[model samples]
Target: MGIIDFFVNLLKDPRGFIAGWIVALGPIWVYTPLFLIVFVETGLVFFPFLPGDSLLFAAGVFSADGGGLNLWATLIVFYLAAVLGNTSNYWIARLFGSRIIDSGKVKALTPERMAKLDHFFERYGGLTIVITRFMPFFRTFAPFIAGTGHMNFAKFTFFNVIGGVTWVSLFVLVGYFFGGVPFVQEHFEVIVLGIVAVSVAPAFIGVIKAAMNGRKGKGGE
Candidate 1:
């Protein structure tokens, strides 16, 4: 329960957590936690719900404050985490996608979602990785689906690198530049929430579309 509360706080106020950690543990230790969170969020399917965008934004805010954390180091770490996380997910799907799907043990890899992901890959090809980088659940699932679909590794790598860097840069820079504005700083949590909402909105739309298609199929039956 305490662990659960900690993560909830993290999602709700990443800035608070990062700030506190920097104060208590000093700057050097903050990177490891950030790295782990980003890696888990992007690498593991079950952890897509973790606060990737917000965390990066908060880290950027901290970096902007000049609180011992080097901005370049933070960006480099984030970029590596994002890329490696997706790489891990891709290899996992490539190796065990069928077995995992058949076993039904993992809730995130449901047949319906996998089918939709496959369709998304078919429609978008390697570009799905790039596009989904800004999307919530899809960002985590894209690499996995591409692996299962046997997308050319070279093509996947190209788009993955671009998406990873762009996604991190956009959120982090926004925080670094505008996060200190009194309005934003005062309503920091609100802004973070808004960022998160915008990030996941596309996935919600896709879910709505899928539901409509499902209903249409039933009606036709």
Candidate 2:
């Protein structure tokens, strides 16, 4: 009924929430969930609210046991998914980024916020692709901003590969390694929450840093 409730339902049963993607393209599609997950999480503008980090964490946990999904296959699927997903998100920005810039929906994005993200991408550059990959919610927007700014496509792609591979590898290996513990199995919710916190902490830190910087700059100006 409510936004939180709807998201809670999704968090409870991803397969149910992700049924459209699963049903439309089965395993024959090779990392179907990975593709759609990455696509919605990154590629689609309307889907900023989707579970990017948590889903990856869950996928990692699921893949740990080798549950009919080979580790290599999972990695390959997710890696490609993440890479393609960002590329797609970037182009989507290229296509419609200008249109949204002045819209009410984007009003939440103050110039200071834009400047912060700009400063981040500037300072980190392509490596933002790599570093933010490990970060949770931030990963979804990195490529989008890169594209919106018309950063070199070739450069973005290079880091996309690095980030995608690194991101998928860490989580899948994590799932593969610690997924089988009885305690983790019993307390999956706690684990998922922890993952969410870990993933979100970076964005939280970034926002706080940005806010502090904004205040200091204003005071100085």
Best by TM-score: 1
Candidate 2 residue lDDT tens string, 1-221: 99768667666654344334435655455367566766677666555556666666566665544344456666777777788888887897777777766674744345654665687787888898788776655666667778897488999999899888888787778766876888877886677677777877877787898789879999999
The TM-scores of all predictions, comma-separated, are: 0.93, 0.81
Model 1 TM: 0.93
Model 2 residue runs over 4 Å out of place are: 1-6, 12-31, 106-112, 216-221
Poorest stretch of ten by lDDT in candidate 2: 14-23
RMSD of 2: 3.5
Q: Give the TM-score of candidate 2.
A: 0.81
Q: How high is the CA lDDT of each candidate model?
A: 0.84, 0.69
In model 2, what is the error at residue 213, expressed in angstroms? 3.7
Local lDDT at 115 for model 2: 66
